[model samples]
Target: MENNMFCFQCEQTLGGKGCTRHGICGKSPEVAGLQDLLIHMLRGVGFYGQKALEKGRKIDQDTNKFVIDAIFSTLTNVNFDPERFVQYIEKAAEIKAYMKELAGEIDGVIPAAAEYTPPMTREEMLKEAKKFGVMADTSLNEDIRSLRELLTYGMKGMGAYGHHAHILGRMDDTVSHFFYKGLAATIDNSLSVDDLVKLNMEFGQVNFKCMELLDRANTETYGHPVPTEVLITKKKGPFIVVSGHDLKDLKQLLEQTEGKGINIYTHGEMLPTHAYPELKKYPHLVGNFGGAWQDQQKEFDGLPGAILMTTNCLQKPRDSYKDRIFTSSIVGFPDTAHIKEIDGIKDFSPIIEKALELGGWQEDEEDQKILVGFGHNTVLGVADKVIDAVKSGAIRHFFLIGGCDGAKPGRNYYTEFAEKAPEDTIILTLACGKFRFNKKEFGTIGELPRLLDMGQCNDAYSAIKVAVALSEAFECSVNELPLSLILSWYEQKAVCILLTLLSLGIKNIHLGPSLPAFVSPNVLQVLVDNFNITPISNVEADMSAILEAAATA
Candidate 1:
């Protein structure tokens, strides 16, 4: 290991160990330490926020903003600038201190912000900083360990989404407190696996609320997403491809370039934006660009247009088109065009000008098209057909092949799972994980595509909506339906999504490529007993087990 700071909070860590020297991400130890400190401060704010809400003191927008910023600031590939990140930490500290002061005032015990500067070393903080009571360390058995880590990673992703929605004026203290309290819990050593299992479900429960808040924030601002086919072609003129997981940033780009000739194409998690009624209304919005996040270096090399990243899943850009990349919100690159917020609006003029300067493909080319828009609304709209298909054996099985992406070779399991899916089976995918097999044509049963890409990871809300709708149509519980959730997790967003599924009592979810670093054995048993959660095996074997179980059930 290189003699510098190292942190591996993401799935693609160096050599499956904590990244040292520099990350595959090109992030240095200094920035990694700052990111860790930022998370610590956010936890403090979340903890303090919980106390304030408990005392009947309402959390103001500033408190909410600080919390959200703190969470998002730590996301993968977002903020690599230590100076700016520390500014966010200091800002968060100030907000947390103010909230503490307010809480004290409410209780008639006036106090000052914790007048303490963090000891200026990563080793010290990692060693002695107060641990959140909720972490499930590596002391447990493998199965439980996996789930605990799974939940924590998902919370991290959910925190990012929650923070973004907060910026849009959407507030959910119930959800916010969960992060603080949950992180605090993960650090508890005495808690049994059963305790962790229950807490894991709560993470999902709150995540569901968070996703709903985001859904409402988005649909209300944009419109309830409708089923619209997105074109996946490179236009004959100048354009820009916007990727990552932020819809607000996408919307801002749409607003900023309303009449400009530059067309906007969705990439990665942004692919589902086409389903949004408001965003799709723009004719300038083209189609999806390349595949998943992991494929960007190849897909983006010497691209004909500029790229705008709103959030995570950014790999190091190759020199071929590195300069064309622009980042906003928490997404940052060393020298990429940073679209700063000006008067509450993100000005994307630089990217737009760049797009025009470098005109896209010279001639309009015929690009292959794949069907999207199979989100919750679209899926539920065809609920009757799906039910009939299930009953009639047109669609024999339903596989929810959703989760995160990773560099592990074992991830081929997802591809094999999707590929080996029975012709009559339906695959519902979300997040960047779907990229493994989404490119293959699965054909459709009538108008429904066999492979339905649910929006982003947060759009797991769509999967739940479809499941519940199907259940209602069949007059059965979700677990009683012929659905199997085979999840691939890599980060915190997946945690929140898994929690949402568990909170709904959906069971028999098969998770992979590996379990989380948290989770105790007792907790694993609790989840297995209650939800029947299990780790994934070979695709064929897992498929056989699922099909056999469905046949017997």
Candidate 2:
């Protein structure tokens, strides 16, 4: 095993370089090594499966779900279980063998262009991984390296959304086809920087499809989000805090715990769950428990309830709550008990018993309230009012301050940016990033709320829908509308969403808390020149610049 790991996929990458010692997200070098091997085997499966597809053999549904989970598992802060990766590698190898059989039925077996070969044992895979980590694939052409990394990161984000949707009985073959295409592209170094950049843009298109699929799954299952006020304070009685963006788990928890004298509350991206009509109908679904995922350690500390993590942005557990933390789906922490589902039946009794034993706060100690659930349907419901407001000069500019919220430095800029927006401007925010300022009062502009909280990060598709509809209403390009996208990036989801925006030719996107470490100078220059992307600086300064630009346009 290597002494250090190299990962630069998220906002907290070390010094805008790679994390060469331990992961900023709490993954060890050994865990990172296994993830590399997992990806290597997946690409091999992709190469063979893709060839089989070309010969008219359809990949099975189980293989599609397996590939989605396998890619998403390697995302930052998602899975830290080395043994879990070992299992995923073994499963991927089995798929590779199946793919080989399928390929054999075709024109004969085609050799893998890359040096990696499927390992028979976990130990062999771990050893071979050392020679094939992200660092080992490093190219002297920084621009090419950067583009390749962008494609891989975007796929991880796409896989996360795909995995969630798959779990809920929805899967798209188009998404699966490109999943293999993107993975296969990662191992092809003969492709030039230009070739990789072109593929990176395609990642945006595929990611949009994946996001759209997840959006359909969520809206159809949970009902489209509407304006609703959620309690920021905890309520009395025993409760369970459900975090991450998995609504299916939340639904099941609410079902299993109904009338059992336990309360359920949303945390982080789960906060918007309050707006869904189906989930909101449950009487025991209480208020939110904390701020963003980054502050969970302090917010969760000493809180007398069980916390269930359904997805990523999971930090290392604090000693105070580590014992009570529960994981489901692809999320894993070494010693914590995981709630597993067998054939759609997830047993959550451990979480229920934990809450019952610990109990929650004695009484409601806080009274803060935040408004959310302004999904595209809700926003477009009042499109005429919004259009009239802009036409009547009641709304001057629209600033979109959204993306993942992280514990890293300079994230405070988002809080300040939202705080300093002019009274007439409508701030549209989504994802975990909304936690930065959701608790604060921005007041309303006429009939509209000053800040609109569209669902989770996947809800960026809703934002795009609203944006495109607004463009059609005004008879202008989306960029020509009175809008600006000031976004913050943390994980691969943001990467895929950014690429989607670029694919749409939406320009002048202000991106921060910092530019991606994977994007080299030359590649960034291309991004700036093509997309007119700007890095965020002082809030007041960036705000002034965007406002002035909007006015001049």
- In order, what is each prediction's RMSD in angstroms? 4.0, 1.7
Residue range 1-553, candidate 1, lDDT tens digits: 1245555556556666556677666677666666656655665565556566667777766666656666766666666765677577667667867866765644332212233345444455433333311221335465544554555566777768787687677887787667656654543445666677677777788888888888788778877666566676677888889988777788888988888888889998888888888788888888888788878888889998999988887777789998898878777767767888877788888999999998888987686676666767667777778787888888888999988887767899999999999988889988888888877889888777788887788888878888888888888999988899989877667666777787888888998887653444655677689888999989878899889988998
| Best candidate according to TM-score | 2
Clashes of 2: 0
What's the lDDT for residue 66 in model 2? 90
**After superposing candidate 2, which stretches have Cα over 4 Å from the reference?**
105-123, 138-140
| lDDT of every model, 2 decimals | 0.74, 0.87
- C-alpha-based local distance difference test score of model 2: 0.87
lDDT at position 411, candidate 1: 92
